[model samples]
Target: MEPPELRRAVAAGRVAASELGLQVDDVVVVHNSDRVALRLVPCDVLARVAPVGHLADSEFEVEVARRLNAVDAPVAELDPRVEPRVFLRDAFAISLWTYYEPAESEIAPTDCADAFLRLHAALRHIDLEAPHFTDRVAVALGEVNDRERSPDLPESDRELLSGTLSGLSATISTEHDRDQLLHGEPHPGNLLNTRRGLLFVDLATCCRGPIEFDLAHAPEEVGDHYKGADPVLIHRCRALNWAMFSAWRWRRADQMPDRDRWRATGLDNVRAALDRCHLD
Candidate 1:
């Protein structure tokens, strides 16, 4: 959705929440992309609104977070008063979560590693159906191939992206590495260092994949703290993540707040990944 449309949808979501008895005094946008995150004050709720088609994914995230909370895992929790259900308003789907105050200092690598181990243990026991991590790669591959949709991407870069994705997809598919429930994007940005402890916020991207996939987004020092994690697989997953994000940025550059900067950085990301994987 366009920026104007997104803002309107989020505003509508806030209004819907108000109707539902949420005391929302102010709405501060935490992030905006395929999903819009609003920090609702007074009542202290975080509203996540995505496109209608993403209702299932949003609901799934709430369910996953609630279940993880049940097991005393370090994860963001949903609002207890409101039942976990998708709130449809306008063209968006919204879900409410209990908001946490950000910690004054960033969480250390060791803290992140320890928290992830606990979260991973809880996630593995979840029986809900989830897509493989590579399925997202497949979607990115499709977007990169849509020249009409991503007209800004040069033909040279397009060919490079296609070839790079194909190789990574094959490698990811045939790897003998053990698979497990992954946080999907366990980078520091998604992690909140609350007063309670380190809690993960974005659950929409959770999926079944190698633990190394989760570590790929973390700092190398953080990966080192994760005992028994394969360094080689972590290296490969890092490359895969770059490829995925590169394709996504290339596809959505026009809608981005800083299109030129994103494109330049995304091109660099793709080039670096290819060189690292020896695919260049």
Candidate 2:
């Protein structure tokens, strides 16, 4: 039951690879969600395919990866056989990256933290144009405020999400002096345990923010392992993250699996996080 977009994406990815003179006989879907990621068969290259409108975002990810690779950051590398740039074909944007075989062992919390620390350390010295974390909050807020985007969301829930996003964004912005380049979402799903060690993928969400903001996306235990992270700021950022995720889940266009369950869970997490914040 592949979505129509996924079918188109697979075709676009294969065509893009062939145009680059690479022989891709089959395409294996590595991941499919908001975007489609295909592994070009026989070639062992990962091709991330999205709509044409995401061309700029894909290009941004390629540039970010290039810079991070130069600094030897713990991030995935762009495919070397092809030009290190995005390819557009059949109304989709495609970017090729090195395919890493997954390691059997799960990444420990300490290992995840160490990877994040290394990534952040490298990111600190690299200069790149990226949005601030508040911009992401604003996008979520826009989704909450737009009835068409979240038609199924109750008014009360909408108000709660809007308030949480706005309040936390303002509070977080006040600490902009501590801001630095951050992996906007370092959650477990974005971390890959490979023979090369824990390498991060999906760099499109990179932004300028406090390190606490990135830690909020990781496991709670990870924060304890990351030195110098402010617990209070992490808590607030966690709540904000939940709100943003909830807003995304509520969107009519969101195609995440088990949307109803994730939407409910996200809302519940946001409420619980808010309660804990209030109690503290």
Candidate 3:
């Protein structure tokens, strides 16, 4: 009835269907495209497909993750392992590394802090290098301005996008200029909880950058709206950073009037975050 959906039934299990060659009657629709995750019932092995455009990056990330998390690594030694590894794909923005696996978890406060340190530590030692991440961010920024290309966006949003980029360029140029190995996009969704402490998946945006750029989003800032495996407080300073970052992003995406966009959605999200624990 329309253009193809991306990774619609990815890690939710359809790929498992292919690998298992399950009987035709066994497949169930767990999710639809451009929406929440799906649940494919009665599936033993969960298999997922990478988003079509993200195919290359997703594949690259999986390879890097497998290599970085290889047998000899301390992350593996310290973390739990699953037999016959399985990962799931869920369209353009998300990918499931693995799930519900268990591990000796860290204390609440130190969870993300320790995880960030550990992630950077592992990244520092990994032999594999993921470059194009810079190019990806650039492209994604351009997409924010590409209204005609985005059916969900309007013309006003396109213009607002232009302004946001200008602001982002200035702020990031002066602020996030440091070069450190980072998880790239370390939002809450990127971190997974397996038996072994917390395992990070979704390295699509992984790259070299100011460690703050990644750590800034920590469980508190990025996942402020919801609960995650990591314990967190509503730290406004960092939370504001993420809020502005996103407002500028949406400002570019919807091309809304400059002030209204941020004040309404962007600042609002930030405010919600700031009010979360009311640190001040």
**TM-score for all predictions?**
0.93, 0.96, 0.58
C-alpha lDDT score of every prediction, in listed order:
0.81, 0.91, 0.47
* C-alpha lDDT (0 to 100) for residue 125 of candidate 2: 81
Question: What residue pairs clash in candidate 2, if any at all?
Answer: none
**How well does candidate 2 match the true structure in TM-score terms?**
0.96
- Model 1, position 273: C-alpha lDDT score: 62
| Tens digits of lDDT, candidate 3, 58-135 | 566655666667633223221132333334434333333233444445335456666766677677777666653344
Model 2 weakest 10-residue run by lDDT: 271-280
Residue 21's lDDT in candidate 1: 91
Error of 1 at 25 (Å): 1.9
Q: How much does each candidate deviate from the true structure in C-alpha RMSD?
A: 1.8, 1.5, 8.1
Candidate 1 per-residue lDDT, tens place, 1-280, comes to 5778787877877887898898988998888776778888888888988878888888888877877788887888888768777788887888988889887987788988998788888887777677888788888888889987777889898887777777776787687457777778877788888988888988878887888889988888888999999887777778778777777777744455666787778778778766766667
Say which candidate scores most in lDDT: 2
Between the candidate structures 1 and 2, which one is better when assessed by TM-score?
A: 2
